[model samples]
Target: MKRLIFFLVLLPSLIFSQTNFEKGEKLFRDGKYEQAQPILENYLKENPSNLKAIEYLGDIAGHDKSWDKAIGYYRKLKQMKPSEANYYYKYGGSLGMKAKEVNKFRALGMIGEVKESFEKAITLNPKHIEAHWALVMLYLQIPSIIGGSESKALKHSNELYKLSPVDGYLSKGQIEEYFKRYSSAEVQYKKAIAAGSTKKGSQMLTNLYINKMNQPEKAAKIKI
Candidate 1:
């Protein structure tokens, strides 16, 4: 009789918890981060392994810049779905953010982990555009003595250029500029301007031509 009474009492709580989770999901989708947090916390307390909820919670944490909590949620999600590319990417990005908040030595360690995670994401999904772009950009930012390679950046940049829309010529130009291929960058930026794809392309071209290519007179002629 006591067991039956306990079960009856628990059923409503279970239903209420489910309702809360559903409402949290709806609120999250509607961009109500403040309203969703408590509900999600409660749901996570009850069901920590809920991947969708965990993912959304991690996103909320990231949106709020709560890097530690975001890393925790993403790490949990990654544990559940180790082979998922998006999970690995998010986890890597979170770690990278955390690394930025720390000292240089600690950041270096996290950067190594970040590289591994991003690489795993790319390996899992070769078409993951953001992962590829981020890896290329990170590589360009670091010194060549520490695994950074302008040639590798150019390789990924070319791949991205092929896959990107015609309007993405500015990005291609930026990548070329990073490789010190100023002439190619100038040509790409000019093409973007001609295509009417980017309003800022002319200004960017002016900067690159003057500062990078040492063509101050040519830069002065650019209208925008």
Candidate 2:
């Protein structure tokens, strides 16, 4: 009688209840992260290695700005779905964010991994805009001795242009600004404005006038 009673009490905890899992998922989709986290966490305790649960928990960690924890979850997702572009991109982005917050040695250590993850993401999906853009930033920001190259940045800019016309001009504008070619950057930003991305185009052009061109009056008068 004692053994039977124990089995009955333990059955609920042992079962992989779909109802509980789906309820948690609904809460997640509804953007109720606080409510969904514990529910999803409890479900995973009973059903460890649950991929869907792992993915949401990763997102929750990102929302919480717990970059390392988010990276851990994303790493698990990447292991489970090696060919998934989104996982690699998210993992790479989280690494970059964490690198920014850490010491120089640790940030340097992560640079290669961050590049590799973004590379994998773009390889899996050529149209992965963020991955490509992130790579462009990496190439632009790091020193040429390590990996940075304007030529490489330009190549990605061209690729981005092919993928997104608006972002293409904006990216080209940024590259010109990096080289201190203010007039060239202005041309690209103008092209972007003419192409209908007025808001970003206007902001970049305004900054250029005020910061690069030293024309604060012109910047203040400018309108999209």
Best by lDDT: 2
Off by over 4 Å in 2: 1-32, 210-224
Worst 10 residues of 2 by lDDT: 11-20
**In angstroms, how far off is 115's CA in candidate 1?**
1.0
**Candidate 1, residues 50-101: lDDT per residue as tens digits?**
8988999999999998999999988888789988999889988888888878
Steric clash pairs (candidate 2): none
In terms of lDDT, the poorest run of 10 residues in model 1 is: 159-168
**Clash list (residue pairs), candidate 1:** none
lDDT of 2 at 182: 98
Best-performing candidate as measured by TM-score: 2
Error of 2 at 50 (Å): 4.0
